[model samples]
Target chain A: MSDSPIVNEFNQGPISCHAFNGDRTELAICFNTNVVTIFRKSGASWTQTSTLVEHDKPVTSIDWAPKSNRIVTCSQDRNAYVWTLDGASHQWKPTLVLLRINRAATFVRWSPEEDKFAVASGSRCISVCYFEEDNDWWVGKHIKKPIRSTVLSIDWHPNNVLLAAGCADMKARVFSAFIKGIDKKPAPSPWGEKLPFNTLCGEFSNGAGGWIHGVAFSPSGESLVFTGHDSTITVVSPGTGDIQSIRAPYLPYLSVIWLNENQIVAAGHDCAPHLFERKGQQWAFSASLDAAVKKADVGFTARDTFRRMDSRAQSTTSTDTEVHTHHQNTINSIRSFSGTPEHVEQFSTSAIDGKLILWNADSISRGLGNLHL
Target chain B: MAFRKIDIDALEEDAFGEDEIDFQEIGELRPVADVDAQVNSRAQEVRSLLQRGNTSGALSTSLQNPPYGAPFHAAKARNTQTVMEVLNSIKVSDVPQLVKSLSPEEQDVLMKYLYAGMAAPEQNNSGHLLAWHEKLTEVAGQGCIVRVITDRRTV
Candidate 1:
């Protein structure tokens, strides 16, 4: 339980986004560029497998659908491509999606059922795209109403009908992405009854209006939680419209993932993941995944102090430029590394500093418990 | 036959299309200011106006306040076109002077706002955003803005 996480630092600069294969053995990462490189994991190390280059601009997001073995990537080029592997040649093929967005696509996510996916764009709308047999390619249906600004992130419900979108409009909205051709009639849920295409179930914002950065559905799909640029995380239980927003003491979070029904892990500009727990009717922040280690000040001496004073003439004592955390820079994404969304045993976080760190859930909950985290 | 009736309520094919406005052109929707009596709150009031896409309204409000009133927030919106509009309508130094008068803490928050505006390296908005930031930092003094970002405890 005390063992360190597996650290993989790439010298290839920042990773714009990354996704893992169904087996968790291969990784698809964009090196802050248009290219997506796939890496195969061998033991504790990783090896490059393939590079998919189709977009003419930087890729903003990536999602790997496990069941279908398909990789979907959206880029600032106002385009998205679905990559499929050719079994005979072992080459990845790109299929363009007709998003029809005039601006950059900001984020994307695959539906729980993996039959379709949603791409959020700076065009003030979301494009729900899926395969069309008649057209022999993927087609998109736009949901443009009520979104006055860019959407920063999106998540699909377990039922595969409702979608939660966090947009720059300072609101988190739940809209039904029920395509007439790709989906069947969805059953009634807490979100709403008689779900149709483009149905906005509910919209929410924090006490202080802030741009929403991250959103996710609880494992039970009964509640939704989102983080905003104002350094706050809000939870909404649509059943009773119970909203609890926590103004975090730390910096803003860029993304969030439900660890289970009761717990969530969020990370962003703070560069470290923080845990939140729900008990009964109350939601509260519980612990830091990377607990701050107190460094003893035993090495300071008069000679060093005088040397420092003579060098810069400043009284600043600390010289360490890095935060005492696993990630040295802003962590942009946190994805499930092992286990299903219902019960994640481990997860991975990638940062702008080009480092990937994987954490074991059991150890985190156990290790931090002793520290009263 | 020439005056056939039509279903006037039918939805247009491109009703929700984004050709009218690009996403980058949208204004930052920060919280509107409450009608507080304090001068700092009044500064925030001008800012709220910009957040709501009321550039002219912000200028008028700042004018009514007189003396120290400056459209500090309207400049911070960083929409480029909006800021340029306000600048062209007044002295370019007016907003910079107001930003310059902001306390060290206020400058840090303003820098954070600018940093967020430069989000997404691929968005290619850093050049414009950085230009404003450089001017503001110059007024705020060297290393003051960065000290806030690097050490949250400082502010």
Candidate 2:
């Protein structure tokens, strides 16, 4: 089923970032390299379609605007490019946007409206870029107050006027990106009523002295969830200032998302996505979506011990080399594979292991119990 | 079924107009820091520092405020048995750094614990100690814990 989560293992090398197109039939990924490769889906397998070779440095992040069918990528070389599929040549054409950040541009995201995008950079600023009609080029306006370190991740509010950033400075902040030139004055949201650009609306620390790795706005844009290097997932409700956090028992997760309003899935160094949900008042770990079933026992014998000792000069009872998870390396990015963010039918995860795994949301919820949906 | 690929043809006929980012603050600025969040070590803050290539920072942290639980907590407890128990869990990949990063006095103390652990009665937990011993031997040839043991012997 297209909605079933499947593990696509193409050892292109550790992937730095990846993006799937609107129909979930194509993918744009950087294989920890300067080039961005596009792949097309056949019935079950993906075939390489085209490669966009432009960035002088490794591409850091990529986002595909589903409605607009445009791909924007940022790289460590301090540049961001918007790629369009040329109708004439059937090739992706690149347009460089003026990010104006001196340090590496670390991450990029398209606003929900698709008319604008935000680029997070190592220079401690979020550059919100939009098409300038008179200038005929993408020009960026900088959000520079209060950000102290590299902006690691940014998410656009559903309203398309608010932006949230997770930075290396151990803080996640929400800012208004309402540019007067493009956006109609946005109506008041729970985050705040002020519609001015670069206004720091809400800011919260990741709560464990770790760099914020990822931040995502809840579908309603009322709550913010972020993963931290401290192996924590913290949720904030901007209206009440009520915060809920759960410290994971495994390695820190780099990415996090709300599966629905009640459930959130986060994954990173643990190499597996974990489920968290609120029950009444408190948030708690529910179950591991990628829990590896135990293998049949291969009875311990003298031959196994001798072989193990001969190889490493040590005799241990067990030599289980594999981590008991599906992903062999850190899962970096987790995006909705199928269905909407409000009710994700399937979700896809890409990792440093150069593997893209698509997971069915219902099946995962089934493993835990039943989903309200 | 194979789905449609995304391209310019997939886009709408009319393009959305864009605007320059207005840097001026147009709305009320909320004091965000007042929201409750912290950087407590319960989230493996020390490991985060170590992974970020802040080894010196990690070392100082461990020396200054070692964790009170698993890996660090045992070492933080500062008892010879607890230290050895923590040291025994070190992977071979981290053995060199574990050995190299500690102060000379700390290293000497760790070696003392290792020597003591070597003499402990072999049991189910003995495998890790032996593993650490073997790894230390490989990383430090003659200058490893053996040298410390011998130097103490001569003294």
Candidate 3:
């Protein structure tokens, strides 16, 4: 509940932010004005790394590659652009532009392997593109049922080359990638026979009452959970085709992430982040974040070492004090939280109010820091 | 005995006198060849009519007094069985409309058969049948009867 300048000002504006990698070293912020700013940590201070100014329309979604070397941003201009940063110069530049989409691009995410990325457009199609090193760009994969209902969210499986896409039609489809041999010719009837390259693994009705807004695969990749316009979370076992749905008290506008195997953190239209734990038969809310700590993790500590002069004793003393740092901004999105023995340092979140907050997982309250926009 | 063998053969021939063989035939009941001829002609006429694409009229005429090789009746029976298999796979919600389209006699037969298939073994025969009938009535509604029939006149 510490009131910082970052939170107080962000309470009045609309912005989107994402922390890159588990350490949250790189932060990307997309503003309402259609500009993206990248920030990196230098010493104890955070500084601007680069500003991406390519999209003519407002940016709808932005995602950092799992490697943190590249960023993908999609916009209403019906285009998705990939931006890569130079490690030596700390400069960011757009390297690839995907064009000729039928509708506005809403969301984009890089796959877990960092070899491919998926983009969801308003035209109800999710296009997955693979990066080719020789060509230095992305090429679209052949997809069946190219035109479906509008896709709301697309997420890649944590362990395999599989993708889960949530659509406006209240259905979620799982797509898996397989490599066909070279010189393979197209079959006369693509739909009649199963192709050798790609496979539609499963199509299930997402029991959430309304449009599917967000979908995420657990780190174990055993189950997939999705939330939608309705205030409910549906968990499906991809292995067994079983569905278990839970109702959340508040409607979630954004997404939910698995904190561990059994715990989940969900944030959205609700001002506070809700932490839920799966019990024997139900999901119970374990904790709620403070209004300012929109997307704070459990660990982070900031330590300052300095020499102080005592006025009464007229003596100088050196003291090292450690303070738990927690993010003090409205968190719009969060990714990756890893715990360690000495310190947990891999949780990051973005704020709409113009702050990119990073927290150490071990001591989130004391180890929090922010990169101002 | 050897000396008497030749005389014994001659005596045996003389002892068995030949009887008179008379060949006399009278007409009793005659088999008719005209019946086979009529059947062959009728079959040819039916074949010609079928080849001319007058299957419905041919079938109608054949149904009045069927030809020797009428195969349409057996094919229709097979079609009914196919429809029943398809209906069995349909969801419960769709079964009522499908059963409604059937004729009243077919509806009755299907209802009885389905009820028998679903009835529990321990239940009384009458009770199970009544319960199944009630359920079918609920699904099929009033004034509707499932019927499956082969109208020989129309065939």
Instruction: Work out the TM-score per prediction.
Output: 0.70, 0.70, 0.54
DockQ of 2: 0.03
Kindly report, for each predicted structure in the order presented, the TM-score of its chain A compared with the true chain A: 0.92, 0.94, 0.72
Whole-model alpha-carbon lDDT for candidate 1: 0.76
- lDDT per residue, candidate 1, A58-98, as tens digits? 99999999989999999999999999999999999999999
DockQ for the candidate 3 complex? 0.00
**DockQ-based CAPRI category assigned to the predicted complex of candidate 3:** incorrect
Could you give the candidate ranking by DockQ, starting with the highest? 1, 2, 3
Q: Can you give the lDDT of residue A186 in candidate 2?
A: 86
Tell me what TM-score chain A of model 2 achieves. Answer: 0.94
A14-80 per-residue lDDT for model 2 (tens digits): 9888999988789999999999999999988899999989999999999999999999999999999
- Candidate 1 chain A lowest-lDDT run of ten: A364-373
Which portions of model 1 miss their true places by more than 4 Å? A1-3, A294-317, A368-373, B1-155
When superposed on Cα atoms, how far off is each prediction in RMSD? 12.7, 15.2, 32.1
Q: Which stretches of candidate 2 lie over 4 Å from their true place?
A: A2-4, A295-317, B1-155
Give the per-residue lDDT of model 3 (tens digit) for A1-373. 1233222123324666453544556567676657776667666555776779988888888887655577888888887788876779767778656545777887888776676777887775677777666787776654446334678778877533667777766566766643333223433221123434456756655332355767877766777777665545677775555677554545353566665556566666554455666666465555554333223332232211121232333232222221122333335576564553122234445555454443333333332332111
Residue B68 lDDT (model 2): 20
